[model samples]
Target: HAVVDTTGAGDLYAAGVLFGLSRGAAPDHAARLGSIAAAEVISHLGARPRMDLVAVAKSILG
Candidate 1:
C-alpha cells in the first residue's frame, strides 16, 4: 500500500494486535492482524479504517 503518512500506523497496528489477541487469536494471528491494519491505514491518506475493522479482520483472517 501507498503510505501517505506513517503517523498513526503504529497505533492502528497496536489496535489490531490487541483486538486479535482479545479475540483469542494466537501471536502470529495477532501480528498478522496488526500488519493488516497497518497496511490498510497506509493504503489511504488517513489513519482511520475506511471499512469496518471487524469485517476487514474477519475477511483477512478467514
Candidate 2:
C-alpha cells in the first residue's frame, strides 16, 4: 500500500527522542518514545499534534 502524509514523521520522531533525553531517559527508552510519537503522528492527520509526550512519559514512569 502506498503511504501518505509522511511529511512530519521525522520531525515527530526527533521531538520524541529530544523530549525523552530532556527528561533524562535512557537511549532505548528514548527510542521507544520516538516510536510511540511516530506511531501517533501516522495514526493522526498531522505530525506532533501538540501532544505532551513528556507528560505522558512522566505519568507512565511515575
| RMSD in angstroms between candidate 1 and the native structure over all alpha carbons | 1.5
lDDT of each: 0.83, 0.73
- Report the number of the highest-lDDT candidate: 1
Give the per-residue lDDT digits (tens) of candidate 2, residues 3-45.
4466687887898888788888888888888877776667666
> Could you report the Cα RMSD, in angstroms, for every candidate shown?
1.5, 3.0
Identify the runs in model 2 with alpha carbons over 4 angstroms from their true place: 1-4, 50-52
Candidate 1 structure lDDT:
0.83
